[model samples]
Target: MKNIKYDFKSVIDRHNTNSLKWDYFDDDIPMWVADMDFKVAPAITESILKRANHPVYGYTVVSDELYDSYINWWNRRYDFKMSREDMLYSIGVMPSISSMIRCLTDIGDEILIQSPVYHVFYYVVEDNNRKVVENELIYENGEYNIDFDDLDEKLSKVKMMILCNPHNPIGKIWSKEELSKIGELCCKHDVILISDEIHCDLTDPDVYYNPFEVSSDYEKAITCLSPSKSFNIAGFQSSIVHTKNSELLEIIKTQLHVDNSDSTNVFATTAVIAAYNESEEWLNQLKDEIFENKQIVKKYLKEELPIIKLVECDSTYLLWLDCSALNVPSKVLSGFLRENQGLFLSAGIDFGKSGDNFLRMNIACPQKLLKEGLGRLKAGITALTIIK
Candidate 1:
């Protein structure tokens, strides 16, 4: 058997290529975007190259083999079975969510979301003229939990609910029992559930992530997933939507027509297949590296910068740093870090009202870069303390 390798020591320059994360600032280390800095798996690269070898690129239909690849992947990795008829392709999860909001609910309807979530969910709801109902997550004992009572109270008039499994920003992996309760609540309320499982594949091996529809109660849910985050293929623009309910699936299909969403890029299709079919070893290595990075951040914060507290995380390379102990506004602290430390992070307020004193850090870079960023952060905080 071949050994796994996750050597992210080599940093490849990504600037000057219209890369949003890298080109956002000059002489700044970007630890903001969710995308990783490591090279894609060799299998994905080989698949893209093989597809590129074709001289002519033309409009194409999704093949049965492509659907089979996704099906096989889900069955093997998550122990969930899906049929081809239940599958649909989209450019990405965000676009799908935006369209689904419009399709599943009418204008002026309410959409429920957990606060301090991925910011895009808020935009998707409000941009579609739907009211956003925020159920702020409860943070205690260094971990985050959903406020189900708040959610149930708010769900009284909600037409749809967006769930972030293995949530973003705080990186809490929702367990099966937790998801079962959510599924039951949604079903009781007769609300359409849009479950985003994009970060499901990047979790630590010890963590457990449950698919929403795996439970009998959540069968009416529409679950979105992709290999983009797992294999560093966000630029490829491909994702899968699974729904067992025919009526809901049809509505989503109709919305696609209304929005003129027809197809995905050819390369993205090939890349997803390769990633799901042949990148397990690489993914395992990447998960280990990410866990190591998480540990390093915890150790550095505890020993070097005890004032900064890390939120409990079990999935994704994103870390939430609580800086309320410093008693500084998050935006002001973010500015200070960017200007003095040359470090870029996603400001906490961007997520929601509950995230004001926190900052989201992306630890998906090489170790050297991670270390340098932490060092600069330590220095910057120490200087701030001295001046104060």
Candidate 2:
């Protein structure tokens, strides 16, 4: 057994603490939400404590340290260099994305997204009154690929498109060739490209996450990211948006103003800086735990629940489970797991129609909790089979 330096072996109860994942049910173990169960890095907690001790919790703003931290992290980790001028801060990635959507497209204009994506992208597109034009991914042989031919056709009609690299739910890290093809189609069709690279840092070191701005094909693209996902600081709501397009940047700023999503919470700036600047070692340790959890799921499913297939995940702690072999709908299966087995997993249907017989399970937790969840899952699926 490999020695893990992190405290991923112990179970920590988050119940009754306003934790979205744990507060849902008293008995149900939530392997649903993307948030993790581990305590944040020491640097992050120290930074927040230092801020909390300060006399004032007044209106806060972005600083050179905040921008510099983000810029430095990207350059240091991914070798994607950018000036402070290229980065813009927003309350959160969703807010930034929603703001950009409003600014880039007219109501009823189409926004393209690959289906079985992050469920929020669907809401951000439709809740803003824009039509959802889905180029559903092709899932076969336990792998997923973009249907670029379909995407190319879809691009002709949509005015804007959002791409999720190191994708949520599916946990796919998009390759440069694949991304360039999409960029080419978007640019050729005059579509505003929005790349959400929030899961970029969660991938293994060798896996390359191509930031849109780094590619000449995606020169006109707008990329949004945050340390929230990578650092487990989603509550801070700090996000960064970058693009070389000056006009698009101005439009995004105007929309952010209209939405009132430009300012940071008092501690967000502090959290971002601490996470990016001082927590790389912590993050590397976190990724190891995440990957270990993935292995647990893979081994458990193969040995205990042979019918369920774990998708090939390159990034993110979220594991996409293919329950198609169980011959149950995702909604029905998810509900069964919650009700019968005390296991709460995200219903795949919420992502899109392409997500049939699939469930997205959050594995960023103590190994003990993951093992418990896996046991419950086997029981639920077995019960379903008996019912049939």
Candidate 3:
């Protein structure tokens, strides 16, 4: 481990802690969920402890400092300037998306999402009684790209489009030209664009994600962001939505308020403030650890398991493994890995139909745990190959 300051090498036990990834399953290695296994930054823990010592855990107000933290962080890190009035707080990104679905589109409206994308994008649209329209990404030569013609055609049918920038599952970071083109297409189709950028901060070291920048004429874009994914503080349930359109912002604020997602918990502000202000060095170290982990997986796959191809990724700790050569469905492969080798991985089918030939593995743990996961993966794949 190159990072001596941050403790990313500790293998902390999370079993029986009401952890969705650990307690909900009996698998020896839980590599399905997106949360990191490493502990949060020292500053974040100290801040939370200080807040916990306070007697009253009552309803808290969103302070100017919280907004300033976000504004300063974005300006410093991404060079993206955000106004205080343009941001709104919510429980999480999905909740904010759900509220936007209710406010912007009517029931039964078609919502567009890029497939082999985040699974929750499907649920938020369908559960709201809206139809899902997929602009399937074109995967060619082991890389993924936007099908602009198809996206343009589909945007005409859908009332809203949810874009996963620095997209999940595949971990592809969309370029600036791509973002500008998407903005242009959405504006042309008069579709409301919701950019889910919760994973923006988890990019490779010195490789930044491009924020969706809309022209002045385009006022239909909304961005949802959070420190939960980067800081491993998802339990706080805090996220913020940003929009340059004043009218749309007011409507969303009302919708979130009605959905009971506007208010923050006592510790939500504390965690966010510390994560943005003080935890940057820890996040930098985390990126280093994740980069090392990716290398470990790459070497293991090349040396021991050549059939399973590791898709190139620039962001996120989730590794997309192309298992099409196995001649087995992703569900079966993932299930076999769990049942036979006690390793849990997310099935690609959960993302979309196009992902059926792939598997998603989370590698945000210590090197010790990562090696164990690789060993289990090799064992499971070898056994499956023998059976076939």
Candidate 4:
């Protein structure tokens, strides 16, 4: 077999494709979005092409073979076995969260979430007229941990909890012990756990991803998985909601029909099948590249820009920069980076109240671009220090 070469140095122009990362600004380097600057796997490209060759695009149902691909992939990658019957198809994790919230909980019910999480979690709860119970994560020793004591207190009123596994922004691959504690608490409180494992596949080889439902205590939970983040197929909009709870699954499916959300495009299924079936080699190479990129950021921050520190991360290509030492508001820092440094990143405040003085940088670009962005950041920080 030929070794797959994951070259992350070839910069491609993505300016005119109406991409949110590229088209949002003129002549700005977009390191804000989580999407990577890599081409889709050859397998996925070929599969889409094969499907496109069919002259007539007609209504289609998800094939059993596609479902098996997911089951097989999970078993092999995460060592978590899932039954075909337990899988439910969805457009994406966010939509599934919205639909699950609407279906499983009543209006005015409370939903719990950890602050400084994916910002959309707040909106997903509030948009459905549910109360958001914020349990802020504890940041100490350069890592973020869930406040289980506070979570226990909040669980009294919360009917559901949305968890981002291999968490966004900070890129934490939550330990099994941590997940066990959460599962025990949620089970005791009878809170429906909605674990979003969308970034599970992005983990480094040494890190472990404990699927919430993989534990017996957490079998009552629902897990959201997708090929979008791992395969760079976000535009395709394909995701799966896995659950062992038959009753909850029925409720979700029924509500999806009632809400007119029980349909998916043909391309999504095609892409998912190809991604899960034949993209492992590409994925392994991508993970290695991301790991190297992450080290580059860490080394640069520690040696070159001592004031700007990176949060601990074991997964995901996002690097959370702690700019608290700079003593500047995150938005101002973001603006300065974009205007003065030509670097764009997501402001910390956008994540939540706890994310102040932090900035999220996407390191999933070509190594050259990643280096340039880091160089600009280092230079910008140096200038700031000199001015101060």
Q: Rate the local accuracy (lDDT) of all candidates.
A: 0.86, 0.86, 0.93, 0.86
For candidate 1, lDDT tens digit of each residue in 1-388?
1475646778878989899899857647889989999998899999999999999898867677778988998888778899988888888889888989888789999999998999999899999999999989998877789999988888777998999987998998888888888888888898888999999987886665777777545766899988889999999888878899888888888887677664877787888888888888888888888999999999999999999999978898999999889887888888888888888888899899899889999999989889998998898888887877
Candidate 2: worst 10 consecutive residues by lDDT? 1-10
lDDT per residue for candidate 3 within 1-388, as digits (tens), equals: 2354999999999987899999998999999999999999988999999999988898799988999999999989888889999999999999999999999999999999999998999999999999999999999989999999999899988899999988999999998888888988999999999999999999989999988853233578899999999999999999999999999999999999999999999998999999998888899999999999999999999999999999999999999999999989999999999999999999999999999999999999999999999999999999998998
Q: Which sections of candidate 3 miss by over 4 Å?
A: 1-4, 214-217
Best-performing candidate as measured by TM-score = 3
Candidate 3 lDDT: 0.93
List, residue by residue over 241-284, the lDDT tens digit for candidate 4: 88989999999988766765666787888999999998888888
Candidate that scores best on lDDT: 3
Q: In candidate 3, how many Å is residue 330 off?
A: 0.6
Can you give the lDDT of residue 29 in candidate 4?
Answer: 74
Pick the winner on TM-score between candidates 2 and 4: 2
What's the count of clashing pairs in each model shown? 0, 0, 0, 0
Off by over 4 Å in 4: 386-388
The residue-level lDDT of candidate 3 at 260 comes to 98
Candidate 3 collision pairs: none
Pick the winner on lDDT between candidates 3 and 4. Answer: 3
Candidate 1 local distance difference test against the native: 0.86
Clashing pairs in 2: none
Model 1 CA deviation exceeding 4 Å by range: 4-6
lDDT of 1 at 239: 84
Return whichever of 2 and 3 wins on TM-score. Answer: 3
